[model samples]
Target: MKIKDRVIELLSDKYCGLLPIKSIHEEDTIIDIGFDSLRFMEFVVLIEEEYHIEFPDDLLDIQSTTTVREVIERLEKEV
Candidate 1:
């Protein structure tokens, strides 16, 4: 699956079960979906494990308004 799809899956599983995975748009911000600091941290860990990558602490400063597409683009650059 594409990174975006996988992200939606992970988010759906851990955070937002009320929304269907397909309903999530890449342009949507994390805050728009109700991701708090704790959930965002969990998401980062999940993404790291799934992609076998260690995200830099600096990257954790990502704003709640950051889009999924933006996050994916950053991750792709890291890879």
Candidate 2:
């Protein structure tokens, strides 16, 4: 699947439908979807494992400001 689709799928799985998938916008921040630090870490791990690519540590630092579109773009470059 495409990176955006996979990202959305992962987000949906993690959030358990708390936010409708159709309502997710590219500009939404991770925290906007209720992703606390721990949950964000877990999601990052899933993404790394799924794509076999490790994101830089800096990503964790800036995760609060990171958007869905940014994540998908980064994953596209890595994968």
Taken over the whole model, the C-alpha lDDT of each candidate is 0.72, 0.74
Per-residue lDDT over 1-79 for candidate 2, one digit per residue giving the tens place of the 0 to 100 score: 7789878878764443246677677899877876777777777888778888887666765456888788778778878
lDDT of 2 at 29: 87
Off by over 4 Å in 2: 14-18
- lDDT at position 59, candidate 2: 71
If scored against the real structure, what TM-score would every candidate get?
0.77, 0.81
Tens-digit per-residue lDDT, 10-73, candidate 1 = 7774453335677667788867766767777888888788788998676686586787678777
How close to the true structure is residue 1 of candidate 2, measured as C-alpha lDDT?
79
Error of 2 at 45 (Å): 1.1
Model 2, 23: alpha-carbon shift in Å? 2.6
Provide the lDDT at 54 for model 1.
Answer: 93
Looking at model 1, which ten-residue stretch has the lowest summed lDDT?
11-20
- lDDT leader: 2
